[model samples]
Target: MKVIVGLGNPGRIFRTTRHNLGFRVIDKFRKRNGLPEFKSSKEFNSLLSRGSFNKEKIIALDPKNLIVIHDDLDLPLGKIRVSKAKGAAGHKGVQSIINKLGTKKFFRFRVGILPQQGKPQGVKKFVLKSFTRKEEKIIKRVVEETVEAVEFSLREGLERAMQDYNK
Candidate 1:
């Protein structure tokens, strides 16, 4: 089974914020694959759905393939980085998942949301704030690319995905 999880804070207010990029990516992937809406699961503390792609059993959630999609403050906006068995780098949501799962042996697709440089905003404030019109346009494209990367990872494997999508 391949599990894909997108890490994000729950609630309508956070829906379009930079911190919610993970959720956005999952939504795109689900819609592209013709899957039904994700149902909220208290057990997982996330929205979840199950389906198959290319004959593989897929369980999509907010935590454990557990593939985590989240925003990174280190990289420039719209950049995508895929890693495996890595540390959370101070991301609370990712840390929570790591703690709950008691392992970091899963794929992570990090979408960069940081401005290039010279921005005067704090990380917390920036991530929680809604994206500007320009950022949203970029995010729209990045989400599609992320969906493609996820599919490629599943169809091929993690190594190839990292090589092709990581930047």
Candidate 2:
């Protein structure tokens, strides 16, 4: 089974932060696919929704068949990239997952959160801050496109998705 994981801190306050883009994408993907609402999974320490896509069974979390969606500070806002077997590049959340899974071979759908102006002064504070009204509009579009990229990855293949969306 394929497992898609959206990494983010768990809390209402983080719901709209740049750091929670992963959660937002997963939420939208779930709703768009008509999956049931996520339920707490103690064994996995995450919210999970189980279903099938294109006749393939999909569970919420697993290592071998994993696809992680998360925010990337390096790329410009609204940019999307699909990669596999790559290092976390200082993303603590991704590093934590790598430590737990003992490998970096899984797929990743990275949505850029950096503004076009440049990197922010304080990385921690910037990531946790809510997007400005102007930025929110861009984020909305990125989320939609990211969702489509993910669907393309599943329908076609990771390499093809990377070629198409990583432009």
Could you say which candidate leads in TM-score?
Answer: 2
Error of 1 at 42 (Å): 1.2
For model 1, the stretches where C-alpha displacement exceeds 4 angstroms are 60-64, 118-121
Report the number of backbone clashes for model 1.
Answer: 2
Which sections of candidate 2 miss by over 4 Å?
A: 60-64
Q: Largest lDDT belongs to which candidate? A: 2
Q: What is the C-alpha RMSD of each candidate to the true structure, in Å?
A: 2.2, 1.3
Q: Considering summed lDDT, which 10 consecutive residues are worst modelled in model 2?
A: 56-65
Please give the CA lDDT of all the candidate structures.
0.85, 0.88
Error of 1 at 57 (Å): 1.3
Q: What digit string (tens of lDDT, one per residue) describes model 2 on residues 18-133?
A: 99999899999999998889888887777788987777789844565799999999988888889999999878999988998899999999989999889989999999998889
